[model samples]
Every structure is written in structure tokens, then in C-alpha cells.
Target chain A: MSGASVLYDVPGPKAKVRNRIYSVLGALAVLALIGFIVLRLSANGDFDPARWDIFNYAGVRNSIRDGVLATLQVFAIAAVLSLAVGVLLAVARLSDHRPVRWLATGFIELFRSIPLLITIYAIWVLLLNNRTELGLSDNQPQFWALVIGLTVYNGSVQAEVLRAGILSVPKGQREAAYALGMRKTQVMTTVLIPQAVRAMLPTIISQLVVTLKDTSLGYIITYEELLYSTRLLAGNTTVGGENPYVQVIIVTGAIYIAMCLALSALANWIERRGRRAKTGIGVVEAGDVGNAGALTAAVAAEAAADTTADTAN
Target chain B: MNVLLDYLPEFRAGFLGTLAITAASAVIALVLGVLIAGFRVSPIPPLRAFGTAWVTLLRNTPLTLLFLIAFFVVPKILFQGASPFVLGMLALGLYTSSFVCEAIRSGISTVPVGQAEAARSIGLSFTQTLRLIVLPQATRTVLPPLSSIFIALTKNSAVAGAFSVTELFGYAKLLSDKGYAIAVIFLWVALAYLLITFAISGVFRLLERRMGVAR
Candidate 1:
């Protein structure tokens, strides 16, 4: 086992035993700590089930639901807009024109560096001053500000992800497109982007997941997202000296986890589909045009040839 | 503007608390992140699983919820109760550790497999191999994303305000509650956050250039 195993051997029995011990110890420590806290809370009567009843109360229900809807609305708008903005900037940055590339670089860097909170707060404050002129009131300012701020920051991040994905497409694909007498724009639009995007769909979906979680930042500016709703509910309800805040917080946290897990599942599915379809479409080999497995072999051959050329030099 | 002057003491305390929390939590998270990253890439399945679950939960959930659980739920579950400051630090450190884990793991993965094998063949112990052969290379790859996460943590310190922790934004909220001019108070709060953010980004810029030269 020792000699035959490669340097990065997938794990042996001793390592497995050691891992189990560590896991058990860690789990016990955390559970014990939790137990101690629960015991103390029970002694203080904080753990009484009566405290959680406010969750079922009509006012709390309405506010929480309304908050969820508002959060979803903002997330939907920002996710779509950010992807569009990301692609535009990614393309601009790749543009051969000097000014287009410069402008794109600056825009991405400026928003990417700024904290999302400042962007939202700044937009909120700025809009507040021009509320009447813009035909809006105070409440509208917070909502719009959250949307715009999230769009800018997430959009910048997405731009980088998209650019990396697009650039990751092999040079041969671009050269072959050009070899066919295709224009620069035509090569990008017709040949490179689709293949690059398919290759990078997993990373793109991962960013969208980040965008969704960032929506909770809207709570800072009082945009009434899920966290905000929970806070308002917790504050407005009273469960004696102990505050029913703990139960309400756990419930709300679980909701967020559910949404994030759902997004991850979707991303995983897309990655599988993309993997199956990737070979048949990119850089068509003359002899392997209709055969899927043959296309993979053709690509592998091209890659091996390229490596040989580099080594031969 | 006169309203802004009334809560100067609260604002000062909040501002100082936020800075202290960010610095302390950032340090703790960096250390924890490195350890978790080691566990993640360890040749042990259980360790790898632990690392994976920690990253998945921490990265997936909103930081605000983490703050709440640390401040309210965890305390109720652990000590029956805890101070907002302790809870805030715990939450922020734990939350930041996850991102740190990801960045460091990415950094470590970028170091070629052959490098580690070469270190081992030369008679380096596992720990020595990591310390001498692996980490320096990983640090360079990790700096940019690590800086971004640090900036994020600074902004997230504002969430402590929600738990009644008197960070900068907490003080601003206090002033607003006290009938001070909301705009002026928030403007000052924004300035405080900006000063911290800009300073962190400035340091990262210097590091990036120096690393570029070293490479």
C-alpha cells in the first residue's frame, strides 16, 4: 500500500480512523455547548413553546410573506440585469478598441471595489434628495437603491467570471473561426462565446447564487427583505423577560438555507447537461462532425498535437 | 445638523467597537481559515467532509442569519444567553472563516501536486512541507480574493448593529432613534465605513504590486 500509492493517495484506513475521532470530538463539543445553553434557557423559562406562537399570528405572517415577495422581486430583477451587464462588460473588456476596453475595465473595478452597503446607502440618500423631482416618495428610495447597488457590485463580479469563462475557450477555436474568413465580431458571436459559455456555465451559476444571498444586504437600508421582516416581528412581539428572538431567528435562517440549496441543486443540474453537450458543438472536426465520442477524441488529438509542438521547440 | 451633535458619545463608542470587532474577527478568521483549508485538503475523508460541510453552510447562508444565530439562538442553546459583543465576534469570525477557507483552498490547489511530492521526497515532514513549500506560493494566489473578503467583512460589521451591538451603524441607528437628523447621521456613518474600506483596499493594492514584482 505504501509504495504503490501515488503521492496524492486517496486516503487510507488510519487516516479514516483519525478523521472519525476528530469529527466525534468536534461534534460532542458543539453539542455539549448547545446543551448547556438550552438548559440555562429552560431554567429561565426562555425555552417555553408559548414564546414561538407569534410566528403563527396573522400580522407576523403577512409581514414575513410580504417581505419574501419583495426579496424575490428584487433578486429576480437584479439577477437578470447583472448577467446582461456582466456579458456586456466582459465583451467590452475583450474588445480590441482601446477606449472600449479601458471604459469596461474602469467600470468593473469601481463597482467591484466599493462595498455593496455604501452603494445602496449612497443611492438611497441621493434619491431621497430628489424624491419629489423624480416623482417618488421616501419608501421608493430604499427599494430602488437596493436594486441598483446589488446590480452594480454583483454585475462587476459577474463580468470577471464571464471574461474568464470566455477566455478559457481554446485559442484554436478562435483561429479556426478566423481561418474560415469570419469577421472578428462573427467569430466571437458565432464561434467562441457559445462554447466558452457552455464551458463556464457552472461558474456563472455559482455567481448567481452569490447574487441571491447578497439580497439579504437590503436589510441594511430597510428594504424589508426576509431578515428585516424577522427583525420587525421579533421586536414587535414580547415573550416576557426572555425574548422569543432565538426561535424566530432559527426559523428565518432555515428559510434562507432552503433557497440557497435549491439554487445549488439547479446549478448542479445545468453543469451535468452542459458537460454532456459540450463536445458535439465546439470547433467542428471535419471527420467527426456527427459523432459525439469521436469529437472528444478529435479534441484530445488536437490538444496532444499542440503540446507536442511546444515541447519540440 | 444640531441633532447630530447630541449623540457624539454613542457614535464614538459604536465606531470604536466596529473597528475592534473587524480587526479581531479578521485575524481569527485568517487563522481558522488556514486550519480548515488544511483539513479540507488532508488525505482523510472525515476531515475533508468536515471542511466541506463547514464551507457549504457558511458560504450558502446569509451572514445576517449567522449573526442572529450567534447572538440569539446559539446563546440560548449554549449559555442560555450571551453578550451581544461576544455573539457578534463569534458570528463574524465563523462567517468570515468560511470564505477564507475557500480562498486558501483555491490557493493551495494552485500549487502543483509535484511540488508537494518533491518536498516529501526531500525528507520534509507534512507540516514542514506545508509551511516551507506550499504556503508562500498559495499566499500570493490568495491575496486578491482575501482582500475582497476582508472588505466584505468590514461592511458586514454593520450587521452587528441589528443585535444591539454598538458598532458604527448601531450608533447611527441610536442617533436616528434619538430624533437626530437621519441624513447627517447616516452620512457620518457612511464616511466611517468608507474610511475603513478605502484603507483596507489601499493595503491590498500595495501587496498586489509587491507580489507582482516578486513573481
Candidate 2:
């Protein structure tokens, strides 16, 4: 609040000034580093017209495009499955039946405890070993491995998020739903889960971002995802050169950054929309309102005077 | 099960390698994470940006990708070779630091600004304020998340097997390649990993309760 800010500046003037100076110096140092890198790169013929021939290789582009698509396919499937799994696990954990709760808890904890990469690797190894007997293909083995691994780990996290969201819902809502003679399942499905999800949309979105980022793990099983494609590019015998490695890495990193930033932007938009949809009654009222408002205003004014007095010393 | 027994020594060696990689990487991650977290919150804009960019880049890429980059790309560019163990540690360290940075940032944010002000008001220097007031509180609040990250780190170290580091899973794979039953060896490997993870989680839970950090 403006009044609160006036009363107690978050960081004092000295610290603020020092911070600004340090920021400017730091920015310049980084700019200089970038400039140096650019100059060195160009001098080393990294940006030469000859090196542009590498992109003309159709196979390179095709593989990358396919990799991108495959990555997206797995990510999309995993996200939806993980969220569904999370919701089921959350509901079961919250069930009135002791066995259901314990089972859900154990499932969530077990999968979540294991490393995601290990889970993926284990599943892949298992599928590969059983493929001949089960009449499955190599691709299915890796694909299923990635999907199941992502689901189990992300689902557990989502369960925790969902549980927190559900607990955050007021007790009165559940009681009222039950009073209406709604069965437990109906109360949960119609009342608790929806409200909890709506309330916890940001956390859910954040987890989704995490899930999207995690899809790159498919690279471990040689799933030919975006990262694997990039690895192929790095090791390309066709584009042999002194230092295509850094260029490939820098470009690949930028692509990843672009996608992640897009996801973050989407999350920000969703958060804004969520805030806009809030009912007036549910909003946390600022302290500078109601009967206490007058007292707070006076106290704030007194605090401001004291701050000024201290600063003038 | 007999297949597992036949390769008990290999499993033992693999378990040790896994433990070594996980512990080494955990130490590196914690130190790297703390430094990066500090840089992220520093008043310096470029340092903060660098930290943020580092976290973003690492978090977005798969851990396997990082390992490949370290093993394949880094050595290629630097015109040197890094052992699989070193490469795995470097990659895991880098990857884990991003999540750890976020955790530390969240923890730092949870510490009341009033606390810092109170420390400063009492004539404590900025360094002293951070060391005594800010860090202790941040470390406490971030314990559970930190523990979870450690467990995740241990699991992720399994990726080292992919690069032929001969860790637990890699060991199991070798046993299978020698015409042994894979399902049996894999189950043993999985159980080994599960046991380690459960033990770590148990310790974490106990610590959390003792520290009154449990919700």
C-alpha cells in the first residue's frame, strides 16, 4: 500500500542506491561479454556463408521436425494422463474408507519417491525384455516407458497439489454438499474437486509447465525427442567443423527458452484471468479498510513520522 | 533371483558407483544451487539475469540432454575427454541446481522482510543479517523440498547408466546382456533404488517432524 510504503520503505535509500549502481555495472559487464563472444565467433568464421550449407541438408531438418512432433505428442499425452492420475489419487487419498486412503497414499508416495529417469529406464528395460514374448515393438517400449514414467512422477506431485487445494476449501462447503443428501462421490465430484481445481489453477498450471519441461527425459531412452535430435545434430558427421558444437548448443538452448517462455506467458495469462474471475466476497480485504482502517492510518502516519525522524539523524 | 545372486558382486560395485555419483552430484548441486540462488537475488541485474537464465535453460532441457551435452558436446568443443562419472556428475549438478535455485528463492521470499529490517536495525551488517537471520530461516523452511530434491537427484543419477557409467541400472543391464533374465535383475535393481529412496525419505520425514516443519 502507498501509506504502508511511506511508513517503511522495503529497502532503505542507501541499499536501493547501491543496488542500482551494482545493477548497471553488472549489465554492462554482461553486454561486454556478449560483444566479445560475437566478435570472436565472427572472426572464427562461425557465421560464414559456407557453414550455411549445413541447413540445406534435408535429413537434418526432417529429423528435427519429427523430433519436435514426437516430443509434443508424448508431452500432451503425459500431461493429460498425469493430471487424471493425480485427480484419482487425490480423491482416493481423501476417501472416507481407510483402505482407499492408505492405498492412494502408498501409490503416490511409492512412485513419487523413485527417480523419474530410473522409472523410465526401468520401464523401457522391462518392455524391451518382454517385447518378444508380448509381441510389442521397439518404439512402443520407449514410448510407453516415457509416458508411464512421466505419469507416475508428475501424478504424485499433482496429487499433493490437489490435496492442498482440497484442504484449502472451507469445511462448510463439504458439509453443505452432504446436507443436500449428495453421496460422497457426488459431493467430491460435483463440489470439492471442481472448486479446488479452480482455486488451485495456478499451481496446476505451474506443474503442467514442469511436465512439459520434463518431456525431454524421453531422450534417455533414445526416443528421438527434440533433445535427442539436437544430440544427433551435434554429432553429425556431415556438418563436421572446428566448432559447430557451441553454435548448435546455443541455438538449441534458445529454442528451448522460447518454448518455456511461451509456457510461462500462458501461465501468467491464466493467473490474470483467474484473478479477474474472483468474486468480491472471496478476495482478501486489505488491512487499510473498515473500523481498523482509521487506527491503521493513524499508526501508519506515526510510523512514517518516526521513519523520517530516524533518517534525519 | 538366482540370476541376481550370480551377479551380487557386480551389483555391489554398481551400487557403490551409484552412491558415489549421487552423493558427489548432490554436493555439487547444493553448492551450485546456493551460489546461483544468491546471484539470482543479488541487487546486480546481470547476475540475477544470468542466474535466471541458467535456471531456465537447465530446467527446460532434459537431464539426459544435459548429460549428453556434457559428455558428447562439451568434450567435443573443448577437445578433451571427461570420464562418464565426471560427465554425469556435472550434468546432474547443473540440472539439479535449477530446481534447487527455485526452492531457495521461494524459501528466501518466505522470510519476513521485517526480520532483515530487525537485524539491520540492531546494527547487524548485511552479511551478518543474511548469515544469522535470513539463511537459517530459509534453510529450515526449505528442508522438506530440499529433501525431495535430494531423492530426485538420487533417482536421476540412474541416468548415468545410460552413458555406461556402470551404476545400478547399468549393472543390471550388463547382467541381462550376459544371457541372464533381465526381469529378475531389473527387479533387484529397482528394489535397491527403492530401498535407498525410502531410507532417505524416512530420514527426511523424521528431520522435518523434529524441526516442526511438517504441515
Best by lDDT: 1
- After superposing candidate 2, which stretches have Cα over 4 Å from the reference? A1-49, A132-135, A240-245, A280-313, B76-79, B123-125, B202-215
- Residues A1-313 of candidate 1: C-alpha lDDT, one tens digit per residue: 2321223434459756865686777667656766887787687676677887777788878888887788888899998888888888889999999999999998886665444655676677677767999988757888888888878877776666556556556678889989999999998888867775665455566667777787887877787888887887787788775556877776777778788888777777765675567463433211111112222444433322221111110
Query: How does model 1 fare in lDDT?
Result: 0.70
Residue A74 in candidate 2, Cα distance off native in Å = 1.3
Candidate 1: Cα lDDT at A102: 100
Per-residue CA lDDT of candidate 2, range A1-313, in tens? 3211211236678978986887888888878877776666666666775665565678867776787788889989999999999999989988889999999999886676555666777778788878998788858888888998889888877776667567656778889999999998898899888876765565566666667767877876788788878777767743445535555666666666677667766666765676577551121111111111112224323322211111110
Give the CA lDDT, 0 to 100, for residue A296 in model 2.
25
Q: Chain A of model 2, TM-score against the native? A: 0.79
In order, the Cα lDDT scores of the candidates are 0.70, 0.70
Query: Clashes in model 2: which pairs?
Result: none
Off by over 4 Å in 1: A1-27, A40-46, A56-59, A175-185, A240-242, A276-313, B1-20, B41-50, B74-87, B108-144, B158-215
Q: What local lDDT does model 1 show for residue B43?
A: 52
Give RMSD to native, each candidate.
8.7, 9.1
